[model samples]
Target: MQALLFEPNVQRIADETTGPITYQPGVIAPDLAASWFAALLQGVDWHESSRMMYERMVGVPRLHGHYAADDPSLPKVLGAALGIAKAQFRAPFNSIGLNFYRDEHDSVAPHNDKLHELVPHQPIVLLSLGATRTMVIRRKTPPHLKTELELEAGSLLLMGWNAQLNYDHGIPKLRYPVGPRISVAFRVRPGWSEDGW
Candidate 1:
């Protein structure tokens, strides 16, 4: 992966909210992404894990889901990544979730990180690898608003307290041909998980 340069610019999608919604570029250096991806891929035991859901258009179980973040090596990579992401975003992240999109067929639907799983107001760091895809962040309520971003390879997107508290984010499916893409979402889950640390 080559070094990626993010032209830091804030694009305000809507007004009368809390604060300005910012979309900063190149938060995650491509070199770090490359090194981390190599470690994540080698360390993770990637497997197909999908939950069946009814497709509105097709009215069928289209396996609308993605791979799980069950990787042993993740904790290590996450530990290292937290430092890098923190320096870039200027915040601390305690937990991380890894998602692997094997191809165009593998994708994630629109959803937010349940407030219960995360701190009341903390940042969620998302790092994209492999290929480019559209990452959509939207306001969950009326005004029916949305902001779309093309997440390129070896890129980092950080949604801080202002963005996390007021908006929801997700990566939607793509129709064009795409290769394997990995996204490691680093967040601050202030409580606990089944895996006792």
Candidate 2:
């Protein structure tokens, strides 16, 4: 994405007691985002896993990476990201969840972040890098409202803790070939101690 030339598409999808579910584009410049993406693509410890699907165990479509906010081994770029997120929402975010989509073949199943694993009332911040992908967020109740946003590199998406209670979001596999993408998710985890923000 051409961050400087790009027009900001900020949308507040919902307003809840905890916070607002919103998407803000071009939070980082394209040059900085490109460097960070390239470094993180090789820097983070990526993991692959499997999950039970239809009574059978199958590989998760995308790779995952996770880290505590205090760990000294985390990539420096992440610290920079944490500062941006903290400045934006001032929540004590202490966990990082990274999703790596290698290509259009990689995707994530529709689901919400586990409540038991997160701190109440804190918003979840996700920073996108690499290729753009559409994320579908659909409400759980009647009418099942659905919204789609093309998450481009350097954009930031903030979903309130309450939003998870009301919606499920996911990235479905695309038919056309696409490059890799990485999503850096910052959250506040219950009972976790962090040395820095």
Candidate 3:
């Protein structure tokens, strides 16, 4: 793995085992990221969500929303971001998932994305906004080695499809207080229905 330090605060992470993962901070610039964050905070139809975990309904730590490729209701800010991702990554992304971490308490468990729903060979692109947070990616098999990176405002993390099959990633909760953060994940799910996954 080669860590290309672009600046004091920005770096790129890539490893052979993890496939083509790349982290580019300042991809959207500070001012633009902040503006997009504010717009998404207000424009998105955010909702408190829960999932059946171990046969019990438990609330997810963050607010969530999804936008289909052709959905007229897709927020302009997100649509623009998708455009950028499409041009840069050249992935056929058709869906956008948004997760709003209100503070340090909000988090996501370490798990791979639903592979069946994603287009094969396409990369999953994550655009980070607002506060910086640590994202941990761990090996799925025994030994469970892990890598941690601070995802800062306007950063981009591209997770290759092969990486999803071999590792799990998440944002762990922090004990100390931190500002809000929002992540926009762009994925390609061909033949997606109105009833999404």
Query: How close is every model to the real structure, measured as TM-score?
Result: 0.72, 0.92, 0.88
Per-residue lDDT of model 3, residues 51-120, tens digit only = 9999999999999998996688888888789888897788878899999999999999999998898888
After superposition, candidate 3 runs with Cα above 4 Å error: 1-17, 193-197
**Clashing residue pairs, backbone N/CA/C < 3 A, model 1:** 6-25
Candidate whose lDDT is highest: 2
TM-score preference between candidates 1 and 2, better one = 2
Q: Candidate 1's residue-wise lDDT over 1-197, tens digit each?
A: 33435564545444435433455556557677667777776676555443446743332212221221233434465666666667766665656667877677766667666767777667676777667878787887687577788877656676655655567766777788887777877777665444523
Q: Which 10-residue span in candidate 3 carries the lowest summed lDDT?
A: 1-10
Give the candidate order by descending TM-score: 2, 3, 1
lDDT of 2 by residue, 1-197 (tens): 33343456678877775246899988889898999999999999899999998999999999999888889898899988998889877998899899999999999989999998888888899999999999999888878888898998999999998998899999999999999999999999988865643
Model 3 whole-model lDDT (C-alpha atoms): 0.85
TM-score of 1: 0.72
Residue 191 C-alpha lDDT in model 3 = 80
Clash pairs for candidate 2: none
Full candidate order by lDDT, most accurate first: 2, 3, 1
Which segments of model 2 are wrong by more than 4 Å?
1-9, 17-19, 194-197
Q: Which predicted model would earn the best TM-score? A: 2
Superior candidate under lDDT, 2 versus 3: 2
